[model samples]
Target: MTGYGLHTPIEYLKGVGPQKADVLKKELHIFTFNDLVTHYPFRYIDRTRYYKINQLQADLPAVQVLGRLISLGQIGQKRSKRLVAQFVDDTGIMELVWFQGIRWMEKSLKVGSVYLIFGKPTLYNGQFSMTHPEMELYNPAKKNIGNLSLQPVYSSTEKLKQFFLDTKGIQRLQETLIPWIAKEIEETLPTYILKSQHLIPKGLAILHIHFPSNMAELQAAERRLKFEELFFIQLKLLKNKLLQTNKFKGHLFDQVGTTFNTFYTKHLPFPLTQAQKRVLKEIRQDTHTGAQMNRLLQGDVGSGKTVVALMTMLLAIDNGCQACMMAPTEILAQQHYHSLLHLIGDLPVSIKLLSGSTPKKERKELHEALMNGSLDILVGTHALIEDTVQFLNLGLVVIDEQHRFGVEQRAKLWRKNSIPPHMLVMTATPIPRTLAMTLYGDLDISVIDELPAGRKPIKTLHLFESSRLRMFGFMREEIAKGRQVYVVYPLIKESEKLDLMHLEAGIENLTREFPLPQYRISIVHGKMAAKDKEFEMQRFVKGETQIMVATTVIEVGVNVPNATVMIIENAERFGLSQLHQLRGRVGRGGEQSYCILMSSHKLSNDGKLRLQTMVKTNDGFEIAETDLQLRGPGDIAGTQQSGILDLKLADLSTDQLLLQEARNLVLGIFKDDSTLDQPKNELLRKHLSRQNTGISWDKIS
Candidate 1:
């Protein structure tokens, strides 16, 4: 069908009136004929094979049988009422039962009718029976099952079933629509691509996806559709990348002058790792090219990302342009400000902190200094993105924990100057290759995949609740060694009231065990005021407290070198990526650090796998890959509502090869035709124009 025909209202389709259309709209979001056509089935059943009643087994999977409804009757009273039909084939007899829809089934079913029933078989009292089996009238003389090979099973909800829009009802709609759609639908991909990829026609793929002739056809249809979905995504990303590099002219920072060299040689605390050096070189090249620099820096926690960021900012300063770094939280912003302040000891550069908690008079002076070109580097939270917080010749922008900030928020920072700044978005979360390709394909990517020298991998240990005393003893031992500890909880309050151990109760328990004068503990969580959280964090940082009991609020920002033991309460409740981040809070210093995962005995399979992954390896990328597999991309990236991840058919976990191939294909196409204006690529251009408007944040990052 043409685009106009595909966009036709679902209410106008055959056998669908306004009420049924509204039900489909509300329940499944199927508004247009295209939506209905693209609602692919999750699985399929083989209708070519039928089992006789005598061959039925309770443990067998769903089976199909041809039989006659010899008798029908109602059994049991009121709520327990059920409609039962005695079905018999040439070999033997079996019972078909319906409980909840008894009245409807009783009114519709006819006795002595030949029916094709499909359902899972169960044995009750030595008799074979099927519950809520799918039934249809059989006519062998007319060859009713002539083309029935693989029967597609669609997903439907209870609400949809009430409106007669069950799986079978949807299948009937497809049966009525696919023949016309297959004949009228236009091809979306270019002829060259279709030929090179050996892909079936778009319309044929659509038909086969919903109603396939065989297993091979279904697989081919899936492959084609997956490729198309991933192809368009990569095309948009790479195109945006091309547009940014070609269109936005960024500030030129081609000098390695006083600030960067003086800090690198004079007051540098340690040598930069090769990975860090490599990333800086990449950024260095990007800034020198004069194209707007939008690079994503990925590294594990404690991998010297801040140092790289500072050096990049120094490069900007050396080029006579100001730089700024934005963090997601006040604690992180403060940490960066202090860490930078300490690192650039007696250096000539002027750095300041800006956040919501900054006093009015201080904010006024900071703003003045910022606009007068006196402030070389400004680190702050979301406060830096406000309209009043403008910068003088802002040339470089570094965002920490980039995913926590929305794209629009980052875009606001991008608009700080007339010409967009060199954007360096830093994330400690290691992204899987597939996810990074799909979610961040538009941005240039650089990964610092190694840790700095003298850093030892944190040893991970899993413990059950029964080992509480031993864990407490170990904590005391660590505390006695003059090394601090951290106890993290998933919840702050007792509101959960379930098996989870919240922070408040944990505090009471800790106080009882460690007793005041000898052991001081600080408590923090998301609900605390900014100042209060900062005070508690400082206590931990200054080693005034032996243990800090907090929630995941400390996951990203708090850095303490003296703290060596991290006890995560109810660690099973955390995702793998989160657990890794929490584990990263310790082990910052040279001494060997340990991460103890304390959980109840009721860990689920996923929870167990997460713990096992933590214990097995300290590689953030590996944990991220496992996290993607366990939680899927939306949960890991928290971009489900961004419209960037609104994929229908492609699975990021399993389709990595296809995604890479699609990206490579796009790169190849761009080499030949940067813009799809050539006559041979006309189909691709048209299809892209018809796609949903590109993501607004693509150009900025």
Candidate 2:
């Protein structure tokens, strides 16, 4: 216990002194004993299974074989040099090779000794080979429990290997430390929890997780550790939610006054879909709960989320409280401003716009109007968060494309009001339900699942770049019908590294194909000046341009009802979510919209999956789920920075059952004991207080 506990420095462990300790800290972040114990293997191997040389297959994951080394020699020149050896068993012979650590391995190889080797097998030139295999002397007396147990394989870097701290080296240190770690560690879960969940004790789980004697033991170890890790996360999120709901008093907008009802009855352009009405009902309920509301709204592109946000804002206005909607980009903010203005025609609501490009005098007038409580609804980007832009009675805040903003920026919005205005965060990028539950676990989620009634399902097609002329013909036909077209390139300039279509090349190609008098073209990109970009986007939106050549700048909010064709150049470079959002740019009008995904023939498997997903279905949730499985939660747009998805073991995409179980258990516990102050829940509080596995999402959300 003195040498090994949660806080024991990793440097004190055997075989880990100053040099190796520094590498461990820098490379793997193993600063303490708990860090080492919890550095669970991404995978493990069963050492007991041994195959003959003849049994080796190219597709084999990792196979173990016993043979006697017949020869050892070096091959190739300086940089390409490798240590090559051959081993022969009673059945056959196979080659073993090592490109790294060649000098050390060449000296260590014994010519005639029986050796046990394990590695992934590859077949080349009709011969079997194993590169960089783990080898050891095979002796019955020395190969006892260690040989029978599942061996851990840790991830290592070239730098770590240079310091003699590769997977095998780290495993040796673990072998030295595991005995004491098993004895000194204390259970993190309570006795009641362990009993109810049928979990093994903490110390034993740690031991078995690194070196399990059998498959059942390994499974049990994984189950216990995953439960503990996921449990703490769920508890932390629930606690944040509870604190927000309990500690902060909400601005009660109980009145369903004129602005809300009058607009719903008359000025509404179309009857609200059942999903929209349902979301509005939920938001309406949250505003009057006497507790600050933190809600997340998720819907596909053109799913009428903005309409719901507009109605909710009117609720705040009806109660004599002002509301503001913040977007990630100025272009998006302006789009919202125009959309809301059109929706609220003749309604007498004084809606104002603010962004980075706002005129000085106009900005001053907006500030005055907002301070005087005369602005009913304000729409803008981060410019709205300026300290000088004070709100008179900001009661509700609607943030569009919520993922584009960081957690701190959102928290800054929270600080804008004394009691923290009711928040409605929205994203058109559909997140999987399981992910939404974890990533936005603290916020109540309202999903508008169905699209509007008049809208038709978009027709999607995958095309090779060789078919560009055919696509051009289709675009010409669409333009002939007075419909605009969008030709989106994945890049703004011709990047030498990536041979994809850029905006400049695309504009030239389109001009040559469409000719001067036949089509007017507008180009926009991120590198363009804000004013110029906005001008080009507005020209395209107003149908002054027959074709718009742009980057993903149109991915967020550039609504053109007359645009009937969306041709994405190098579509394979775009992710599933981005492709879906870009496809959303079209299909806004009723004239049979089409989204043509144009990419080169050389698409990787992942790129093929993305393109196939776009062509297969328009279901955003389904596309989001496939994207999660393909790109993982870390690479997804929002979850990368949000530490909520920084899970070590439990995968939000696949481990839904475990997440649900943990969430349900926390719900039950909080129902009876909100603070976890009950006598039986003391262990939970202690565990949560010391939770430092990764970044804490409590303060972020």
Candidate 3:
């Protein structure tokens, strides 16, 4: 009953009891004795030098020897069983094997005594084995008084190693619960953040992070537990973004009437890029700050994010408030309701389209013109979060590819109206700036990053497979200059573990290279039938298919401006932000488009750094920081079901300078205690009120 604030009952500690404390509360969620002393260990082995079977090799790293079973036996039988043994040490002999338990390791071998085994050693057949090593016995004055100098490991489960809880039985229950609570672990940071981040006190950083007596106190106990787990997850996402911008209260939109200057001066189909007038002047200064604009934007794939989400839905229809946009498919809400009815042509602004295939009398007259504010902008999919979709004064929503929708489907579009609207979101993938500083650190981001002035930079290249007949003669010279062609692939069949290019055998090898009444193709993928992938993506968006043959489900809903060559094939099975979104579906046409990539002359150094960063330079934040340093932030936190960087010792891709020094010491402790009601920050406010995670995986889902 000391400072781990003892909630005791881990079936009364000492090697656990009530059935290994119900298998340590069903496989390692370890209930109490403060979850078995904060079940830490995920690495640490040094066992202070031992290696000697002639210092084994095969890329030797994990070692420790002083061996000797020198006997045991029994091998290959039922399910090819094994046992082996041999061991030896003072400079030679090896073997050890097990193939699991081997009759409880032949009734716990003791033949010729001397032990301390540990692991890692391979070299098979020309001899030297090891298999599942870690043993014990040998003593040497209790291993020089620091018990085998550093050990820890813990992360177990094959049903808690069939209840012996392996990781050396959870390091023999943390070597009996760390000398009974490592002298009562207490300090939860704040002795001026332990002498201004020099750290190391919570009881010697939990007894040198479980048994460290050396390697510089295990790198100062892994920098004081990865700066107390990224300083309480950036002080719980900056105190739920400062208590949600001080409890809501937003809807401001000071009118920019005449439906946003009559569509930015006569239906603006081009010319907004000064990074779209600096992200429409940061969404018109966050809808003239009354707060609720949860921003984000990002931009990249044909950056003109649906023309800055239709000029911020014509600034919520010039303030009489009503706007929406949802996406995440209905063929990207009928490709954004036919690109905002072809960019507000004839704009007396009334906009519609809701989906799940509308029509029941056009979704009952588009839900009585979106609940009577006579609909000013709707565009849909996730069927506009139907609670029978009501919004009359929706006041700007826009989500589109917002990590393909989640946090309870964008909190049912923030429970529509009665305040809480102004959102924005958008994505076109390009996230990495340390995963938008730990998952869109409470929004407000904006990016656009320039692309519109006379658009041409595409030109990529990289071919191979002997440039398939010079990429079918540069796709029949860009389909005789009427320009189109996509080709894509990375399997849609023929996958005996990928040697890709399949989309039905690349459209039966491009219908024998430009066949069918002089080349016609189309295809599309995610296994069609969304009205047959919107009729083969509107016959390659009305250029009547010069060639589409897809899969990467036209990565981010097709928007074809008379296509203009993409190609891809196995291009080293993609990912550099999916070959920069399949090279932004071919520079959304203004001519000179090309992407190419082909592959198969065996690429792999991350497929030649994603075809030399797609022939060097299109940028999407430098290919999302080289796809977050080649495939990491767990594939961009796999659609961020926000586990706030489910970090174990911080690493939002190599700790951005310890995540900006744990977000600048939680912004200088909320700038000298903004409600952490100072008492020298009462143990950082009772360890953030006992690790309080009351929902806010950056606002839930």
Candidate 4:
């Protein structure tokens, strides 16, 4: 087969038949011969060096040597029988034991035979021993028998291994493919680029990856493969972005800053922060351009993004265009409606709300008013995308909390109008700058770095579970002072299936400790009905409940300013960003707020770092940076749902410099030859095509 072509079926390959091939396909996802060849080992066992029995430590994993086996014996009867062999090598003597598989080793081992054994060595009662060490027959003709070298450990199922297709079997397949790859595959990269990058050839990389002679060769092969994977994935995303930019034309609302300036001059609640003004200016530039403005507006909580979005919406309305804002939930949509109604009260524009639960009569009226240009601003959840809803002239579509919406859902909103509406995606979760560049590369980004006035910094504290009584006393004092409290647990009820039953038990204990008569408490959780959840939320919002005990459902947009004390049980269970969002809920009011993170006495390294970051800074951006460092790009910003690029090998956190270099090189190549038809560019294209089969470069061109 050629380099870019598929390999023959595994059934046709040596040793493998239809039944064995079926097992390999089901267990390892390996269907073809090429799939079996390319299923790389997760880890390599280095056997190049061996340690004497005396040097073995009980805690650390080490490989030790044993001398010739003087005698081999079996202990116990039939089912419970175990084989024991004693030997000595260099420094000391040790015993090698194997259970239930003594027959195989008995045939391989001979009395007074010296064999090389490798396994985790353990010391028990001043005696060293290894359980089931991988053994081989002693060979006197082999040179430098002590130099064992590294062994590639490929993952395999017991059923497949029973058929002799284990790691060693896979290694044999790899050995067969190496020569074919070298002879049939052509070098797609130019010599200059390959030499400049210090990259190994494809054939050499494949061989070294499977069976490296040294550590340096293994590292080089890994680097080359990882970089190639990242480069092709990025190339595909960039190509899609280019196609969108060239094809999609925006409405391009004419700039009429008169209305915007009037609101700022006369009716503005407070002076706009410099950060807000800067982001607004950036949005204005994008809106006035003819190209569809796909921009990401990112800011920390309380960064005045709502005000900026309101101003941008007004700009569209001033130009005789309609605007809509889509929020992730109904509560957030209602909150936006209330805030905008208050902000634009004196203006002539009409603002309306349409949620999933909106009355049929009200929804019909909203649909009619929107189509007749009676509605200037419409705010809702996914309900706004229904077929009956139509806009007079939808110009701008603002999506609040961009991570919550799926790609197809957003696309449905874009199709609500003839020309795709200019998109302004807003996210309250601040992302690290390096990650933002890679994830949101297709969209221009504007960050609001400043918080609005009267926003007090929240006081954060970390406490162990042993301090629960003292924490409860402090919570009671705060409640006595007329401040509300929120107690959040990770789980709603005790599950027989889950390991963490403490959260559910804690909730029940809290109910008993602070009974409803003493403290008006309301509970909300994920499993509750929507109406029940809304009722509980309303009770808390109306001050009928002084304390709210809930799960992470309140993590998104449940705004209650009266709540001053926030307590998270088992804070170690949450991610850094999630902890930050839960903390954001309490500090919204004028009163002083405190966030107390309660964790167990024992914490993992990452958990300790997460809690420490929370205690050290109230700045969401700083917390986000720490999260990016601790969790890496894939988890910090969920690539699958965030519309971010899902990279196979490139780690956005550690490989920022390499990512920039790759981006620059790809951009430079495309700038000179858009179709990548030049001799050098053609090689780069072929290289990418071989690496990423899912990306259709021909369609892109």
**Best candidate, lDDT:** 1
Regions of candidate 4 where Cα sits further than 4 Å from its true position: 1-5, 62-66, 137-148, 155-169, 182-192, 497-518, 625-636, 641-648, 684-701
TM-score for model 2?
A: 0.94
Question: 606 in model 4: Cα distance from truth in Å?
Answer: 3.2
Which pairs clash in the backbone of model 1? 1-184, 1-185
Candidate 1 lands at a TM-score of: 0.95
Per-candidate Cα lDDT values, in order, are: 0.90, 0.86, 0.79, 0.78
Give a tens-digit lDDT track for model 4, residues 1-701: 34333366777665677987888888888887567656887778777666777778888674746467778888888878999988787777888899956897888788888787878777788897899887765664764312336677788778878777777777666666555654544555567657877898866777777778789988887777666655665565566556556777888877676777788787777788899989988988887877777788998876778889989998888877899999988878987888898888788779999998899999889999998999989999999877888999999899998777666677777888888788888988888877776667657889998777777889999999799899999999998998889889888777677545354676677777778787888888888887898899889988888888889888876778789999998899899999998998888867889999999888999999999999999888889888988887767655555534545445666776777766676677667866667876777677656655352222211
Taking the tens digit of each residue's C-alpha lDDT, what string does model 1 give over 129-222? 9999988788665543224679888889999998878988998888877777777678888989999989999999998898788899999999
Instruction: Give the TM-score ranking, best first.
Output: 1, 2, 4, 3
In model 4, what is the error at residue 172, expressed in angstroms?
4.1
User: Where does model 2 exceed 4 Å of error?
Assistant: 57-62, 70-86, 95-111, 120-132, 141-145, 691-701
lDDT of 4 at 367: 90
Clashing pairs in 3: none
- What is the C-alpha lDDT profile of model 2 across 24-44, one tens digit per residue? 999999998878887878888
For candidate 2, what is the lDDT? 0.86
Candidate 3 CA-lDDT value: 0.79
The TM-score of candidate 3 is 0.40
Q: Can you tell me which runs of candidate 1 are displaced by over 4 Å?
A: 1-4, 48-61, 76-81, 89-92, 100-114, 139-147, 691-695
Each prediction's TM-score versus the true structure: 0.95, 0.94, 0.40, 0.89
